[model samples]
Target: MASNPPAPEAPFVPSQRSTEPFGSGSYRTDEGPWEEWNPTEESLRPVRGRHRVAKQRGGLARSSTVLGVGVIAAVSAGGMASANTGKPPVSISMPDLPSVGSLLSDDSADAAEAPTAPLSGIGVTSADTAQGTTDAGEALRTRIMAQAEQQQDQVDTKAAAASAAAAQKAVADAAAKAEKEAEAKAAAAKKKADEAAAQKAEAARLAELAKQYTLPTSSYTITSTFGQAGSMWSSGYHTGLDFAAPTGTLIKAIHSGTVTEAGWAGSYGYRTILTLDDGTELWFCHQSSISVSVGQKVATGDVIGRVGATGNVTGPHLHLEVHPGGSADGIDPMAWLQGKGLTP
Candidate 1:
């Protein structure tokens, strides 16, 4: 659809045979043609309407204009193909046409004087025509590359967020685990400290109670224990602890108490009953003599009586009984003495 300017024509040269004067009615040509020259208005009239020329195909005309146009078309097509396929443009070579500039007639020379039109459409600038790159195609490629870059950036941002969240979660989990371990250690230490404190308090309480109590007698040996199964007394079992000793062995008040009974009768001879402040009673039975009288308050370790074999006795010993709250049934005297921090 596009073309180049036509080439200039060569100068005209008349043959030697056609050199006769213009007044003659005949003319001579190298081809032996004779023609009469007449100047008339009808013969010189300009042609009207469009004149169609036959199209040349299969081969190019031996004209420099045609060759230039073919070369331009081939180069344009190659550039377009290279741009589309992202490949280099192929080189195009024009065939040599000998004496092509001299072959043009006067009509071609006139056409060569006309202005040449652009190969592309209107509004195409000289800068746009370089490298055969169209405005529309370049714009499309630019937009596509920009979109691809944007999508890649979005993917990278999401990946970074996920990684940060995972790291934060790991830190939180570790902190929680450490806190739990610390709490457990603190609790264990507190429990151990409480147990040690309890043992120290118990020891201090026993030492204070030892100051408030004393043993009933010294230089004595245990002959019978409470709860022994034997036919030794009126009761079916022994209800008192027997301390065997030499006669006249002094017995002392077991604790700070008032003497509730002395000079007892019947099975208990010379028996002395000492009542403690808490209404618990200590009975010293089978004594050799009674030194405490009823209603007399005595301190701990004060002499109360002596050991002897009296009524319902088997040998020279003192029978001791303990009655909590003055109850008729008595508990084991050895256990009560140990409760007061006394081993015997």
Candidate 2:
């Protein structure tokens, strides 16, 4: 009751805020209840050349540019390093024009300079960089060592080849020399053999000549005497005497006389003649072989001929004929042999 509480004051009118979107990126606030809250020209208008980019995006772009610059610097450094360290130089030329020349910048001016910073954070100076020159010297030494090794290999191979060739040539020469020596030895042997053959042939010819003329080589008992009226010869005479002996018997000469005849005769085959110093002649007929030659002097007991039945005889006998002073007519051979004390 407090009088109906001031009769419900006129439905309490509260002040209303201006209707606007919550953020700038919104629907059309000017045509809606948010028109009064719309931004004015000063608020909506951007600075003439301002792009209104995000702070982080601008920073990212700057960082990307920096990284690109670093990459370019690294590439240039690598190129300069290659040029100084025995690599082929980079050449650039213009298209459709003469070849261009090169320009030396700071990098080319300090061509022999070494890097001051090490990978492990060591540093050096321009003139003091010579202290780091040990690596370059080592590289140079390695290249020289490789070249020397290659040269040595080539030399060794050539020397080995030459040695092998010399050995082969020596072998060939030795073989040829041995062959020549063998041939010479063979030829000498053949010559010696031929000379031996000639000597034997000469000896044989002399032996044959001795056989042609022979004298009685032995004394024997004369059973049927020669040149007498006896049993064998058809001319009513015996031309030779018979002596008994075994085969392979030894015989000797009658007297020391020169042989005048030997070998076969017409009536008395295998006959021999001996001429004495007094020109007296003695004949021995029917012999195997004569051991004396023509004009050969003989002594008693010398082997003049072997007894054999080669003449006209009925048995193995010695056919003898004697002549005084080489006369054609023969004398009694028995008397002649008896005079010489040869019983035949």
Candidate 3:
């Protein structure tokens, strides 16, 4: 603008930085950016021989700290690993090695010292680490085994309790079943006894009823009986009882009843029927004489007829027949008489 700003005054230029080293008596500057520097004869002269010696000492100090710390760490790691795995430690060699106790001693001056001897001179054995690891491993194994035993004992106790409960339940069930069976047996026995007692009571009642009746005739020979096979009668088998006697022998009533029938019954000859109150008819057949009339009442042992050789008679005898409800077929007269308490 104004004559091109008077030909821009020459750009500001700074002096070149000099990299010459300081005097030997001066402290060095190591914190700054590096620059190419040239040493002076005065600065190099003082450190020429002693410098290498100091560096060697420093390296030894560093190695002692590293080796001491590494050995402790390796030992500790090996012991822990061995204890966990239940195995021996891996072999690691340390030359001219002192005891760990001495190396780790609280004295700072002693820990600063390094092993001065060569690698093949002395060392710690692998057996030392193995011994320590074995002791720790055994302790751990004992603890584990103890815990396992305790758990097994607990399981056994629980199992025993359960078994006892099961046994008790089985016993109770068996007892209940037995009790039910016993009750059933008792009921069956009681039922059988009651049935027997009822039968005995019925027999006693029938026996007392027998005492009230008597036989129809006496002092006569039993020539024939009911159900006897004979061609002398018309009905295949004898249907009445025959008491043989002389003609005009007396016949009597077996029980007290009215005379519902008293007349000649054809093949029955002269017959007299005495019907008891219970509708049982007593027939006196082949009679020589009839002494009772129809509608006449009679008593037990009353004479109703006499023995004679009447119609259908093989001999002079009294034929007695029993007809329940006045039906044609009659039962055995001898059994009927016995049932009526007479043993003819």
Candidate 4:
């Protein structure tokens, strides 16, 4: 190859003076005898001194490119950083720079002209871009707040529903309890009404029976009740009701009956037994005299005997006993008379 046109002359650059002392064999001026120099860690170590860097043709453009790249990186990561850290967003500052096309081209004239734009206008553009980032962050925060509010509303709605359900359940339970209570009260009232009606009917029946029955003796005072315990009675208990009256007080038939017996008895003295149509025997014992003979058919209230103390030797009275179907065992005469609607 032809010798490269003669290596171009290097451009002149002024050198800065150092304040450090020179080595023993070193020269301070350019015209001195030169010595070889070697750099070492000790020599290269930084010292406390004012230092200055000389500006080069494209230095400002390179610095602007580096700062712009850093600003973009911070902007891109801003949202995520704020979200992750849960901290306030920090402001990013962007310095003025040459235009994008000027930075990419090697044309010195374009680079020089790019920075000539008004700084205020460039500042406004940078401010707008920063504001956009700030707005984006604000929007994210608002969306998060809105989501939180929505979640809270959901919780409140569910709670309200549960409360309403509980209230309704309580109301239903109360209604059921009240219904049961009402039923119980109604049943009790109905039972009471039925019992009262039954009692009324019983009273009317007894009234009708009284017409077909009569007392065994009139104007007689009751002296003893049936089933009275006493040593004087042969069976250790008095088996009949005693009606006391003057001697010869006429005893009447208790109902329409036929005389089954009329004669003297051992301890009973004179006795008369009337057998009713239903086969119930009424005994009029301790009588002074019996007016009816055996087999005599008698109507209700007909005279059958007279009060007496014929044998047992007590005051004058009619001892009355009742036997169902003429059975040997006698029942309470007082109760039997009551059943026939005869008080005496």
Largest TM-score belongs to which candidate? 4
Off by over 4 Å in 2: 1-219, 239-242
Task: List TM-scores for all candidates, in order.
Answer: 0.46, 0.34, 0.46, 0.55
CA shift at 322, candidate 4, in angstroms? 0.8
Q: State the C-alpha lDDT per candidate.
A: 0.74, 0.59, 0.72, 0.74
Per-residue C-alpha lDDT of model 2 across residues 1-344, encoded as one tens digit per residue: 35544565453222433344433455443432211222345554343431211122224466456546755665676566454442332333212211111111133433344334322222335544565577688889999999999999999999999999999999999999999999999999999999999878866764553453333534555666656685456667864445634322445655667888877886676778988778988777777667777888887667777777676765666666778898877777666555443444
TM-score rank, highest first? 4, 1, 3, 2
lDDT of 1 by residue, 157-262 (tens): 9999999999999999999999999999899989889988987786677668878788888898998999998876788899999989999999999889999899
Q: Alpha-carbon error at 234 in model 1, in Å?
A: 2.3
Clashes of 1: 0
Off by over 4 Å in 1: 1-192
Q: At residue 146, what lDDT does model 2 achieve?
A: 100
Q: List the residue pairs that clash in candidate 4.
A: none
Per-residue accuracy of model 4 over 1-344 as CA lDDT, tens digit each: 67657888654232534333344355455431222233344555444432222223356677567657866776656655554432334554322343333333455555354442233343345755677779899999999999999999999999999999999999999999999999999999999999999888877888888988888887789888888899988899989899889998889888998898999889889999899888998888989888999999999889887888998957998888899998999999888778867677
Instruction: Residues 95-177, candidate 3: write the lDDT tens digits.
Output: 23323333334444543553333223233236645765788899999999999999999999999999999999999999999
Error of 3 at 179 (Å): 6.8
**In candidate 1, which residue pairs get closer than 3 Å at backbone N, Cα or C atoms, i.e. clash?**
none
